[model samples]
Target: MKTDVEELTPTRVKLTVEVPFDELKPNLDKAYKEISQQVRIKGFRPGKVPAPLIDKYVGRGAVLQEAVNDALPELYGRAVEETEIFVLGQPDVEVTELDDGNQFAFTAEVDIRPKFEVPDYDGLEVVVDDAEVTDEQVDETIGNLRERFASLTTAERPVEDGDFATIDLVARIGGEEIEDASTSGYSYEVGSKSAIEGLDDALVGLSAGEEKTFTGTLVGGERAGEEAEITVTVQSVKVKNLPELDDEFAQLASEFDTIDELRDDVRARLGRQVKLQQLSEARDKALEALLEKIDIPLPDKVVEEEISRRNQQLEQQLQMAGMSKEDYLKDEEKSEEEFDKDVADAARLAVKGGFVLDQLAVQEELGVENEELSEYVVTQAMQMGVQPQQLAEYLTQNNQLPAIVSEVLRSKALNLVVEHVTVKDESGNEIDVDAVQRELNGETGETVAADDTDAADEAGVDEADTAEVDTAEAAEAAEPAEAAADAPAATAETAADEAPAAEPKNEGAKDA
Candidate 1:
């Protein structure tokens, strides 16, 4: 057997392989055995029929076809290995030559990873906002906490701002009632400014049983931008009764005994959350900047495949939402051509980013640790309101765990770059690494070491126990003779932190 390789592009290769008659004989014999088992001769037992007898009955062409089918994958794999091509997708195999006692020749075209020089990432300067937790922010956080525990009470007066109202609404175009423009006993909040322009104003000053008519344009829906006469009849009004911000209220609302303690805790939590958001944004900016400096040509086939997958997923999502493709496109304000153009750009970005991150991971020798992956999976499961084992089963059933691991590793590589980079503020001042990390992790402006004993204790897990389950599984699968071989590694925790481990089922729900 022999193989020749030709470079078609930076990320594509064409391989021509030739298998001599000696190499083809084994496949021919195996093919004959397989076919002999499927056919029944008058006096011959199943699979006991001779090759020549089966060939005489089934035709020589059928035998050759079966042999070729069985041999293609093995031959292609050998050719790929011999040529040292890191194929990305399934190859397009074309048999070029096949003759009796001669040579079996074929060509395979495939996409491969493009080799390129990585830019210097260490000490790369990036800008991030200074972590600043203000009194106003703390106050807002407290107000939100209070709102969460607020009680709704019926009111006997006209609807006002911040008050909830039950109303009957009817929309008409040129005084003709629209078929889908009426709702009874719809509960709306005055000043929410969500339903339509002038809706809140119309609800205000209207008591129960009072009716008012107004005109507004449908901001969305089939008749978007069309003016419609709307009649609103107020059925009831209600107001939220907020608890007092006192020690007694704190006792009822949380485990804290006093309002001061609750307020302090809320402030700390809010500060940490804000810091985490800033860190995430900063990391994104830094990554985007670094990618801009790098040159990576994505394989066309990879981009096309990704685009097809994304489009399919989008179609599935639309169908599940009881929406047609046309309706979805209309809602996005895009034509088919426009949507395709956007999808192409997105696919290119995805492929390029993946390639660049993978290269970086290789260069940095960064990997996902066992404990980190386990912790990640466990954390994700908890967030999804499922047990860790359940989440694992779900991921396995969906065959998404590997993809998740890949994503995790990519993020870890990015974090490695970020760790060495110099982050500055708008004023050109070097940002404090501890302060930035606190903001990024939403750690209440507190800088804690990754191996913080107190945090581990709080989480009910010691450092050793945190090893990722996937890594452990891999190690157990390794044989003693092959134990010396490098074991499979789990995905990085930082990557898991950046993206939700599992895709969210509902946009409104917290990610797992």
Candidate 2:
């Protein structure tokens, strides 16, 4: 058996394989045995029928065809391993020559990782904002805490900002009542600016038992973007009574006994969050700098699929949120053209980043150990709101473990890049990314070693939000893996970040 690779493009190849008759003998035998069990001969037992007898009953062509189909995947995998070509999508397998007991020749054309030189990853400088927690932010945090403990008291005055109103609403579009546009006894905060457009403006100055009719356009439901006359009746108005920010309030709100102590704790928490933001900034900026330093030619087919997958996922989210695409576009303040461009750019960058890191992982000979995979599973399970066992079972059941392992490898590759790059804050002070990560992980407090500064804990960097729905298909989740023909693309974001790990399910490897 032999295989030769023909380069069709920078990102695709054709494998011409020649297998002599002896190489296919095992597959032929297996096919004969399978067909033997399915057919019943007058005197022959189900599993005891001979190969020649079975072939005489079932045409030799039929057995050969089944054998070829069963062997294509294994043959293609062998070709990939022999050439060390990173295949993207499934191959287009064609049996060019098939003569039983003589020769079997086939061709598989597949998308592959384009070969490119990696730019120097060392000394790449990335600048991040200073990790400064502001007094105003702390005050806001405390105010939010106070709001949680606040009590509501009936107010006998006109509805005002900062007051809560229990109201009933009915919406009619062009005089016909709209379904899903009516709710009773809904509690709303006047200044919260939630629920409907122009709701707060209409509610203000309307006293208890008073009714107001306003013209507005419904943003959701069958009447989305349709002009509607809404009538809102305020059944009762109540004002929030916040507890005083004294020592008593501190004890009630938190474990701290003193107001000053609670404030200090909040400030400390803010400081930690600030550190996390610094880490995220460094990561994004570093990746951007790395991308700018080199040019990567991404495959059009892969990029197009990525864009399509993202659009589909976005549509799903919009449906779940009861929003139309037009409404979403308006809310995001983007035109259709602009949104398309952004998706394209993001998709390209994503693929480029993955390709670069995969190359690094290979060059560095980085391998994902059981320890690393276990740690990642535990961390990812926590983020996905599932037990580690449950998440593992889902991945294993769906054949997604390959994707998860690839994600981990890519993350370590990125971390390796970070180790070589120079990172600093806006003030020109060198930023210790790993140290900041350690603080978040509660690994150390007093001092961090040099290695710790480089091996930034990959967990706790919340740059991307991932929702790991235990769905069977990844096409329904987020972006599918790169032109992953037989395996998933390396999608590790290093921080074991919330990534779309459920890769798309496709087994065929064919060409365009």
Candidate 3:
């Protein structure tokens, strides 16, 4: 077997492979066996028919096709391994030679990872917002907890902000009543700004039994866009009486026996929340730093495929939502040109980030351990609300395990970068993400370094990588003769590889 590669672009390549007849003999034999199982020959048992007779019956071309089909994947994979190209998706294969007992030659063209130098990331500084829990913030947290223990008391005074109003309503569009648009005995919090527009204002000054009428657009149903005149009657107004802040109240609300103790606990909780936020900020900032510092050429075909996939996904979602692209654009306040350009730009950022991380994974010699893969599977399973076994089966059955492993490795690579970056708070004090995480988890040593490899990292991938064809389908082009020969033959189809979660880290001011 001989293989040679041609560099088509920084992100793509054309591979020409030559397989000698000796190497293909095994596949040819396998193909005969496979075909023998299917075709019935007179005076020969099914699957027991000899190769030559069957070939005479089914044609020499048919048997040759079967051999080529079974051989393509192995040949393609071998070529890829030898070339060491970071393939983004599937390859386009063309068989140029099929001389029996002589040689088989084919060409495979594919998108490869872009070549780029990772910028020096050590001590790459990013300022994050202050994570300090202020006294006012503690007070607000305690107040929210207090609200949970609050009791509603009927008030003698008029409706006001913070008052819960029990109300009734009638909606009429052009003096005609809209049935579903009206409700009675509904409990609404004044100044909450929920429900119909202007309803809060209409109820603010109304007393019990006082009615106010206002016009607002209907949100749904037959008269969805029509303006409706709503008449709201306040049945009663009640204010929430929060529990007193004292020892007894503290004991009732939490395990703490004193208000001071409760305040301390609230402050600690707030601190942890902010610490999580800061950790997230640091990770985002680290990735942003890398993306900005490094330069990579985006593969045009890969980008176009990504954009197409996402657009298809979007179209599918819009269809499910009973909307068209035009309707969706109108709803989102975007023009077709703007939406397309945005898609292209976003695709570039994503593909570039992927290339960078993939290179980093290579540089660090990162490998996805079984434990890491198991953890990733568990996490993904939880998110999808399925059992681990079920998710594992699906992923394995679809040959998606490699893609999952890649996802896990990239996460580790991202974490590796973040480990070297300097993350500081707004106060010019360095933010020690590891130390905080250790404190929060009640563990010691280098734990926070692993925080960035979370699935939450992939939150904003609504329009990413939808253009990836099934792995089986992608490989099919390389071995089409075999595919046509099989009658409902089962072949593994690899699912689209998901992008490892990443984003800009410093959207807000540096954390303190």
lDDT of 2 by residue, 364-435 (tens): 767666656555666666556676768877877877766765676666767777777788988899987776
In Å, residue 365's CA in model 1 sits off its true spot by: 4.2
- Comparison by TM-score, 1 against 2, better one: 2
Ranking by lDDT: 2, 3, 1
**Cα lDDT tens digits for candidate 1, 1-512:** 98998999988889989889778788889988998899999899998999889879998889888999998988887786677555676789899998877888999998787877569877678887665778898888777667667766778898889887879999999878875767898778688776768898898899999999999987656787799999999988878777889999899878999999998887766655555555565666667677788877778767787778667767777656655677677767889998888878766666666666667766766565556556666756544556676776776687555555555566676777677777777678786665556544353232232322223213333344333355455323432112211111112221211111222221221111
Q: Per-residue CA lDDT of candidate 3, range 1-512, in tens?
A: 78898888777789999999789888988988888989988898988999889778998898888899899999998887777666656689999999988999999998776666677788688999898889999988787777667777788889999788889989998788999888898878788665778988888878998999998887666887689999999999888777788999999988888999998878776766677778777866787788898877777877786678667767777666655576577766889998888777766766666667667776766765566666666656645756666877787697666566556556777778778988989999987776766675562221232333343322322223212222333232322112111211110111122222223221211111
Considering summed lDDT, which 10 consecutive residues are worst modelled in model 2? 503-512
Q: lDDT (0-100) at residue 212 of candidate 3? A: 92
Residue-level error in angstroms, candidate 2, position 393? 2.4
Task: State the C-alpha lDDT per candidate.
Answer: 0.68, 0.73, 0.71
**TM-score of each candidate?**
0.76, 0.85, 0.75
Q: In terms of TM-score, which candidate is strongest?
A: 2
RMSD of 3: 9.9
Give me the candidate number with maximum lDDT. Answer: 2
Q: How much is the lDDT of residue 238 in candidate 1? A: 77
Error of 1 at 355 (Å): 1.4
Q: Who is ahead in TM-score, 1 or 3? A: 1
Candidate 3: where are CA atoms >4 Å away? Answer: 156-158, 172-180, 207-213, 304-347, 374-400, 432-434, 443-512
